[model samples]
Target chain A: MRFSVLGVGTSFVESAMAETHGFADCDMNSQLLSPRLRRRMSSATRLALTAGERACADANVDVSSVPSVFASIAGEIKVTDTLCRNIAGRDFPLSPTQFHNSVHNTAAGYWSMVTKNKHAAQALGAGENTWVMGLLESCCQLRSLTDKVLLICYEEAAPEPLVMGEQISDCAVAMLLGIPSDKKRSVCIYQQRVEHAGASTELWSPVSAALALAKAVRHPQNSSKLPISSTAHGWYAEVVHGE
Target chain B: MKQLSQSIPITAYSAVTACGLGNTPLYMALESGKNCLQPLELFHIDIPTCVGEVREVLPEISESLRRFDTRNARLALATLNCEKGSVRHAVMHAIEQYGADRIGVVIGTSTSGMYETELAYEYFRDKQHMPESFDFLNQHAWGATADYLKYELGLSGPAYAISTACSSSSKAIASAQRLIASGVCDAVLAGGVDSLCRLTLYGFSSLELLSEKPCTPLDKNRQGINLGEGGALLLLEKPDSQHADRPHLLGCGESSDAYHMTAPHPDGLGAQQAMHIALTQAGLSTKEIDYVNLHATGTVMNDASEMKAIKAIFQSGVKCSGTKGITGHTLGAAGAIESIISLLALECGMMPGTAGLTEADTAFQYDVMGASETTASVRTVMSNNFGFGGNNASLIFGQYADNG
Candidate 1:
């Protein structure tokens, strides 16, 4: 089995539910979303689409042909807060737009809907291992149905008081997978199970799957296997090592 | 396509709805031809619209689930209670009976813990204070419901939440069947659950899709949709000698319209693709489908487009019905809940009527069964769910053990 990392896109952190800043700004991590649409959407939707679009652009792949898999641990927490409040208030009414945006896959759904890509798309949420699971599912789907897949993993900043002092970072990463061609940049997904992280928790944290993946693609190590801790519980980390 | 044979099948099933609990009651009510919809009374529904609110109440959580006060937690715990215990308990029984660690749990939900998290934020806003009980990891994420199930049940294999709006839970079951077929999980617990929240009401109202009176799916005089909430659970196992009683999850197809963010393509192109995919994957032509559980929510765009999609896919005289008229569109849980209804149809070999559907929108071509049961072989059935942002999924299920 052969696959390659085709393209990648990302989003810098934005405050909860705030409009994403323009991509050209020094922080170029985020992209501007139309005010008309942003007013009706949640931050999670904005961040996911922004990063997804960039990744598609990087891979030079048309969004229409590429199947997409969105992996998010926590999606649209701010919307969750608002919906919960309305329910508890008993007299408060729910917003239709907010309700639509509140759905978990709204981010990925928006990406597909906006891009007008009728291809396969899915939104998956797991625990810490969400990124890893997302990668695995993306690979499996790509291998099963089509020749290529675009996997976008993102975590939006949770609304205040929701994180409960949990050290959370807002990050988004996209990877394009397909049968590797000699002329194209490629990587092979090597699956393995390891017991522990070699370094400190801060450096070897499970959420660092993105960093490891980025590093593996950026600087290919001699070893063909990379070990990762599970982002979700009880699951082992997998390494995608290639030359 | 490698001549895809040996499709997945739905075996055993159960559900809870505003109509009532259990297959027998729901089936009885559907057969009685009485509308189960009522005003949104579960939470002081401030929006003043009708809802298919499941007849449930705040539950007394077990010592194990006391900390999970989010709406998803409440629904999960209540659903488990309805089934007798935690998912682990249920799966253990299936495993002991069926004999396999290859068991998997796939669930679909939309609001999830948002209802609880909103309450926590409201605590800070209304009382001008925050609560210590508010845990972000537990209540505010999309995966909270699935994660809670995994933890509570100790499910070690593949587990995740499918968040495709109304079609979510249904997709979970479909995906579980794929994994099981691919030899990922043996037996699977598949379904979806969601609770009512004010945000949903106000949100739909803003879109002008909410109805003041009961929704009428195919009625020319239809006003709008009446949103509802509930949960359904089904136990799916790979057919074997030990398990001769369950239904089989035949096949499934998923597609996105990518046409509009909120509004479905006027032509129902995405919906057409979804239905087509399911039919093709099941390796059955349109003629083979005994009945269809349409995603007819009564909204003008959704109904018209879905009808168009249905007409384009099925033959001129294919039998189909929209049960949402009885259940009141369960949003993310619709797919899973409706699948149970489809399974029920296969179990009894009777098709439930399209409740509240008075006038067949003459524009639709297929035979729309309303307010009655249509008895047929029901060897193959298709269920459709289209979500916001163009996400659409279709599942096909066949009667279990059809050697006779």
Candidate 2:
């Protein structure tokens, strides 16, 4: 199956040159959300919303009209840690807002509320393969629904206890994908099942996968295949840049 | 775009909830209008709230799968082990027909083994050292349930976890249908599982959304939701000539509220749109629906908003009920669990009443059943599940008639 990349948005390391890649610095102040809604959002939700807004803006599409698939490896880890800490301390009363925001779909929910987008939204988690799985889900939806799909993959660093030893970065990536209405699309993504051992990259988290896919979309190198995960016979993408 | 609705056959399904161990108990509870809510016993919390805890002893995992052992996984395993492991039987048959690589697994969960994470945190808090056996991937990851199911079933198709709050499992079913429609897989094991943890109880309590008594949806005196724990699984495959008798998943409609994170749209716009989409996709009108399984969480806002949506969709007399009074709100697993209930309603020709409902809220015009009834010849039924972040989903299941 093939799909066209219509727009791309990336939120890299805080100090990195994210604006150069069409992403603004991760800003918590979102004009898309009301002040009340903005105050309740976590860092992860802010990152996802920022990237999603940028993607929609880049594509010049109404965010509310396009269906979205949000993928994350560890969802709202800081909130999870907060709840864990409260429970560990035998704190009888945990903050209700924090608890509700601790769900894996918190970011996705915030996206919908902020955008006022009532379209179908899905929140997915697949460990380190979240981005690829999310891509697969989006492509399937696009094929079945025959509509544009906004795909967002994001992750953030957690506190100490949940962090363990794995080094995680705060980042988010968004892409507007669809069947090209016009032939002038810059890149067409072809999905193929390949032997998982053909080529692989060491990915610490789902954010790396999103960054790699964003890189491919940005550069549009011809005849390039990116392994989505380390699974032996998983699905990989073959990028064909259009002239 | 008007696309043909993919009629996926639910070959096998199972659920383990607070009502009992298997679908049989769940069906019986629904039939008898049983309320399974009980005072908190499994763990201690200072709040005075009731819960729908699974009283049945969960099966112990084998040594190899011990790393994945957790309350949530155990509840999921218990559901799969129901009816002499009917889900496994269906999976094995699908494997024989389609090969393991062609059958995928998609599990929906909100808090996968979060209880284990809470325990690990408690241990660390006291010992100042993380436990040696603490594996985040196996226990705390949101994909842990899917991973555990995949490993246990030995299938290799496109497996992942959906975590769209309460709509997780409902979307999982929709995703499975999409996977089949996209020709990505021949068959998919799709469902949801969520085991109760202190975080959820305290979380709901913190939100003041937990009812001190058993939840009473659509009742004038309703307070809040009574949290529950359960797991439900369904084996979905393309409708073939041989399985025409099986219940068919007619259509799925999903929408985001875009209203609020914790609260629903005041006017139930998203909820109505979701139900509308489901009815449109199913090629049915409001008159064709025999029953509606409401997503009423017993909270004042949820019930009121859902009533508005129901009023906007169906006619004055369309029968509706909320099963949370019987099973409590199962959170992420609710979509699949309630879908199973809707399937049972279609198959058994019985519509479960809204248990614990003393008096219907007079503000709504819809008919909210307060007692179970066996007179309805249920053919097509819709199950509604709305989650946090204003995520809403509605699934329509139709009773299959063998034309052959």
Candidate 3:
């Protein structure tokens, strides 16, 4: 029920984390991917890799050795919309690269290739509860395997037609969690059971869960509880920062 | 790397493919060595290709679930409706034993209601406006299938969708096992469903990975894959003393190739690792395996790499076949569909042969089933499903024994 948060990474609004001491720019550079692969990656993939690499660097862990779970609300909308447009045009041939990168796990696959991480990589989608579910899956992995898990959650703005008046944005967050040790500045994540109720109205957006979790991590307080997100069974996450 | 202390049971499962609407027809086709692939007819494409389209006239969704209707969801509903609604029966039973909140749903899908989006786009192009009936929230969402299934079944547990391409469903099964093992849930509905669409058809064709003829895995003249569509679901539960007769999900091994975006490793290192890991976790040696359902999509690289991995693992005695020659590659649903086929092999004591394979490739030293079904006393079987992102997964299923 307890784990250490060794590192944290975020790529939300530009310059939001720039003022923090340990935080770096949220920009996704071409350092982790080749030019060709970088060009082929969608915005979601870039955000995920950027946050994952930064977390690994911040934690002083090798990216290739860790198992990872990537979560997203909407995956590769740009590529999907483009493909739909091409199909509507009765186009004989669609772009092969776009099709390959269109899968929801494209970013996870690209991360593996970039870091040569052969361990298990999982990609999941759960409407607004993606971040919490990703954390839950990672915690389960850590408990079962006795190893650190890299959890990354990202969301890309859906196209205009798909968004249909909803306000979606681009953001990514990554965390390294494992059994708490004597390591410096490690926060404990506690998973608790709560009563079933309607989803909370506080910052109810796809990216809000990760943003809230990041805020708590950056500015630690005494046992501050943050509501991650609610699931069908009213299962949600609340992080407890250790003193 | 730790092994599961107890085995999980696959209490119920159903599959709908071009071979047939239910498990019986699929099993019959495998027994008779029938190939159900025909020229692609579900959609219009300028290229000549073949696909394993579900020929059964799918039943329309009920009025209440009309908003969730799509080719993908309909295929899923049809597959779930198979075995006389065995999945529903199993779920309801689980709800009685474990609270509805104690059951979880994990489904895998690559394209969920994408065909509807394509249609809406077409309508927009012609009419200069989107159709009023188009429901993007219900149809275009990647988590639509899982949400719909959860709503239909009225299960209030953790539900999500895994979208790791072809390995999606296989990983979904693995994730469900984790949920049970972690004590987060007592039972889970785990599987995958993907319906054929113009996006996939034209996409594969553009990649030059689509074959005009039926795919011939391990054949000397194997060219490429023949894409197909279908749905497969499995109800996995934590086994106790009472559930002794259910088929056991022995173990699941997952690994990323980290080699390429689409192409597999030439030496099949990741595939071998997955098989080795699965065997280790199952506490069984390679000699104990009786059959293997290969991820051979018939593409030159895919078949060759998979053969290397299979040869390295089982060597000679184990029987292996790629049913994609019959079912075609079902994309994200391939893992679950093939797992169901593996379970069928265990139950029926019949090893399905590669449907379209004529001349076996001489480069590999493994037993690849040909057009004839191999009747053996199958005990332990393995199914491999590797996907576009170099994502690889292998699952081991064993015949349930009362003495265990």
On DockQ, the leading prediction is 2
Give the alpha carbon lDDT tens digit for every residue of B1-404 in model 2.
74545677889999999989888999999999999999978887888988999988899877888878998889888988997899999999999999988898888898898988999999999998778878776788787888788878878777789998888999999899889888888999999999888898888888888899888989999999999999999999877978788998888899988888888888899999999988887888898889999998999999999999999888555889999999989888999999999989988999999999888988875579999889658989999999998999999998873210
Q: For candidate 1, lDDT tens digit of each residue in B224-324?
A: 88887777877776667555555677677788887766899888988889888777767778888888888888888888898888888874657788887
DockQ scores of all models, one per candidate = 0.46, 0.72, 0.67
Candidate 1 second chain TM: 0.92
Give the per-residue lDDT digits (tens) of candidate 3, residues B237-282: 9888676788888888999999998999998999999999888878
TM-score of 1: 0.87
lDDT minimum window of 10 residues, candidate 3 chain A:
A231-240
After TM-score superposition, the amount by which residue A56's alpha carbon in candidate 2 deviates from its true location, in angstroms, is 1.5
- Cα TM-score per model: 0.87, 0.95, 0.94
**Which wins on TM-score, candidate 1 or candidate 2?**
2
lDDT, ranked from best to worst? 2, 3, 1
Arranged by DockQ, best first: 2, 3, 1
Model 1 lDDT, full chain set? 0.69
Best model per TM-score: 2
Ranking of candidates on TM-score, top first: 2, 3, 1
Residue pairs in clash, model 3 = none
